[model samples]
Target: MDINMKKILLLGMGLSSVFLLSACSWIQPLPGAFNVALLEEKDVTGCTKLGTTTSSVLSHVGLYDRDTAAIKKDLILLAKNEAVNMRGDTIVAISPLQDGRMEFAIYDCVK
Candidate 1:
């Protein structure tokens, strides 16, 4: 392969890697994790507040930035799994996402 061809091949591989990483999420929901619902704070009235959860994920996979929607979704999934660990059935976002981190309040509204 010529020098130019080798450089192009390396560049193509790097771009492909970035694209794959950006398109995929490393976070996976645990079993029964999705059973926990995300609700608005006002809607959780009368529910017992169990505790708080902080979920974080990689906002950028290397030089490629992940999609904002995907980051938000992953954060929610992690928070839901955490609510399950707390024996809660619902979660409310307590703060805006910042630096790939978010906070949520866990509640048991079904009881």
Candidate 2:
């Protein structure tokens, strides 16, 4: 009877030890302890196109530089004028090309 009792006690203790050790392992931090949850991506848009126009103020020998300056001023004025006309939400891209030409674009970025 004593032998049987000892055998049962040993089996119970072994089973409990196994369960306790398994539970203890789960208490420790995992390999990726610092892992963070991923965030959802957000939509974003920027300038995608450009438009340009040019006006010839004058064309004469030895005065090309002066004409070029005038053309640049006119293009700048035009761009400012167009920019003011934009209302609410607007995206704009501006660029200047050779020979007194200006380029820019504006588009609705939000849907």
TM-score of each: 0.89, 0.30
Query: What is the model-wide C-alpha lDDT for candidate 2?
Result: 0.39
Q: Write the per-residue lDDT of candidate 2 for residues 1-111, one digit (tens) a residue.
A: 699999999989986765444333112222332231111122224432223233232222332243455455544444434433442123232454465455645333433
Off by over 4 Å in 1: none
Per-residue alpha-carbon lDDT of candidate 1 for residues 89-109, written as tens digits (9 for 90 to 100) = 999999998988999999999
Superposed by TM-score, candidate 2 places the C-alpha of residue 2 at a distance from the truth, in angstroms, of 99
Error of 1 at 53 (Å): 0.7
Task: Give the whole-model CA lDDT for all candidates, comma-separated.
Answer: 0.91, 0.39
Q: Residue 63's C-alpha lDDT in candidate 2? A: 24
